[model samples]
Target chain A: MAEFWMSEIIKECARQRISLAEYIIRGECENSGSTREQVIEKMGKMLDVMSSAANGGLEAPIRSNSGLTGGAAYQYHQYIGQGSSLLGTVMSSAVEMALSCSEVNAAMGRIVACPTAGSCGIVPAAVLSVGVSHQKSREDMVMALFVATGVGMVIGEHATLAGADGGCQAECGAAASMAAAAVVNLMGGSDEQALHGAAIALKNMLGLVCDPVCGLVEIPCIKRNAIGASTALVSADMALAGVQSYIPFDEVVTAMYAIGKQLPAELRETGRGGLAVTKTGLAMYETLFGTPMSL
Target chain B: MNATYMTGSYSVFDITGPIMVGPSSSHTAGAARLGKIARILAHNSVKKVTFQLFGSFAQTYKGHGTDKALLAGILGLNPWDLGLRDAFSLAEKQNVEYIFEPVTKPTQQGWENYHPNTVRFLITSENGEVFDIVGCSLGGGKVRIISLNGILVNFTGESPILVTRHYDGPGIIAAITSILYQDKVNIGNMRVDRKRHSTTADMYLELDSDVTERVVEEIQKIPGMLNVILLQRINEDQSLNNIE
Candidate 1:
């Protein structure tokens, strides 16, 4: 039928110029009527859930019958280990699959542009980090999720969340959009600035792809999620600080969708392109699946 | 709530998979969303589903084993498809025909904020009935039920909620509520989805209990709300209730 968001909601910028994070922050300050403490408290609660899940509560879902998505996140949190410790939060919240770079985390997470499992960590990481920094209450995290859910609803309405459907661009890009929009909301962003931040965050990840090595959710999948977590936070900060995308959020999404359509199957979660296609990629595939993936 | 999140039209009652469990939610959940939509579109038995998957979803269908998930869902597997993961082998055993397309263009676009997750299915029956639904599986096992053919419906497994589209009119809400009220169904929270000025709109109501067949029918008869769907509470399908 008709796509949800045929029109752009925020502007898009071609280059990484200005403190887009700060821009978004200012937008939130200007619009959202919520107090700064309200935002901080919500961010804190998100950390509590993540911290608890990361430690040992994941099996509760399996024993209780929660679906795979929630199960995976909780289990992964447990799988990584947890604590009130800073590093533990960073590690568990991050999939850490594999990466070409090792940037020092300033308690910030980047959205790996797109790619679900890996992309999940960004928002959680940022929100939690902010929580710890601000000494906020845990009661607000759930509220933050409600807020995040609304923004996510808008993006989902307007864009794609399928790696195969669009590319890693959609996965990590969408996650970044969610993370940015969510963080901005928590930090007291107005709906206008929040949507604006999301547009910018998504625009940054215009043509990412889903290249899970060996078709497993490890490797780049894990690391990508962490990067996405951090990047989304950065974008959120920029939006709050008054960074503008030049082109609206809707236009960026359209461009991303267009780019996704042009992506080859090899780059779109086939385990045949990007990092999955290198000499190491072939070796990894041979090691795991017992042979090279045929196109 | 922003867009039609669960529209994969084809099988709410297709009998292809053996109790529909999964190796793939695209095959299983996406298929289930379609089946649910089918049930919503036509309260009658579905005849067929022109299931379609583009890009990598098409390429790795066999490996991911989505074919069986689709078959089983058409056959009516609740969310708890233990066999969902092995659906391909099972589908092969059952022999259901499915089509594949590699649309360099994705079914859903503009959501770089999430993942590029979209799967569309065109389900039809031999008796001249057809519908479509699309889904987005946002990583870590989360999925968004996008569009149901054209009847925009949005749902995530959050609550035991039911959403219906009705010809915007007075008394319809009260009439629909009476059916649930008679059934002793507890209304946890309800939101009438209206953008600005409302016409034919959607009503999203979360319930504290499972709806009975009668409740389903009563709400359906409420003059303006066209089709009604009872969305189960989050984790209801694959959760503790099915532990046995």
Candidate 2:
């Protein structure tokens, strides 16, 4: 129950020439995990983040400083006004993240699949933000990824990072949390801030769901990462500025799971509840997908 | 069966290989790391080498031009050398002999910890000296020297000096450092590590100085001594270093 020291993790990795994935995966396997299980678990948690963000996130309920609501593009415009070009870059990259996987699914062979097809952008978007914003060298990128692996391990332990278990709140919310923690660490966020960022992200996205229009990860999953990233930056900033979450990280994860189960199956990513159930959503689904979607 | 690779955004992972270049990425970049690892094992003597590889590496060693890589790495080539492209064919350029073996069997249990696509080089020199190195390519053109002999040594080329390990007692560090001290070799920092609570061990010396062939041979003679690091810096006059 000792606190995980990012510096020690990095130093250990430096003394060894293994990637964070290999290092953590090796540790997990040593502790009795199959390779397939580890990658799948990571995917599942990330998908939750995307799926939740596609549904309404707490950021929506919070006061938006900008009133630039037009279409999907308008959300991007909001991210741009949030001050940091890095935020804008992350949001744009999130779009690219979704498109890349779609292309990869369409083209390149996958080592493995993403959490769902929808939220594939979250991890990659967050990873790129570190390289771009912090100007991490190639080796540093590798090291940061290792640090990220550790943070993700903690998240996977603390929360249900999957939409199936905790709706998108645990899923995309957790992914953004992991991503935020990593970017903050790379950009010199203290260990306290990094963990705090993750906690705050979970607190904000407590009861999200996976309601893709017409049951696809494409329509909303991509945009969700961008918005989630914006919130991640805000949460990380708050944590960095000495705003601390009173709830322990483990408790937040447990609460997320409880809240997720309370959600009807319709909201658990079946695209059967919430937005998918609304008349307007149904109309949009019929127009975009087909009539008689239920049949 | 699992070739896992994670290419972070904006990063390049050139796993593609079997080129006409003197040293293929898998062979040259990967091989030098392998050879350097070999030097780390066997107390860094590496009197001779018997290398084993699986599948693709075994099949296309020649065409992929891994020979140049093995040759230079066996000769201990610089990682960034353009000439390394020809290492497979040009190993004769270094006057070192190598015999390759293809391992058709799946890795032994617990060996699962190592890479599936691995090259285990068993090396020795003219004096009946010996070394063994385990090498793996972890995508993005990055290579890892997993183990030396039986001891695990991590080599990232972060420091320029090589490492050697043997029965650890008095004068080991002194024997190595004294030579460097005598040669005016500057020690930047060292990553000397021991496993199993300090029984047999390896010490990675990142010297501001360099190692010569003569130094390696002399270090080979010490009692209970294993190997000496085989690091020879290429003279600093290559155009490739300044590439845009």
User: How many clashes in each candidate?
Assistant: 129, 38
Per-residue alpha-carbon lDDT of candidate 1 for residues A1-295, written as tens digits (9 for 90 to 100): 3333413212211122312233222223334334545433433433443443232223342221111022343445455555433454433343322121111110111111112333444555555555555565565444444444444544444556667677787766776676677677667776567667777788888888888665544446545656676676777778888887688777787788889889998888667788878888778666654556675
Top candidate by TM-score: 1
Write down the worst ten-residue block by lDDT for model 2 chain B. B11-20
| Model 2 lDDT per residue over A177-196, tens place | 66666566656666556667
Each prediction's DockQ? 0.06, 0.01
How far in Å is the alpha carbon of A33 misplaced in model 2?
Answer: 11
Task: For model 1, state the Cα shift of residue B36 in Å.
Answer: 14
What fraction of the genuine interface contacts, i.e. the true contacts, does candidate 1 reproduce? 0.01
- Please state the error at residue B164 of candidate 1 in Å: 25
Model 2, residue A197: C-alpha shift (Å): 1.0
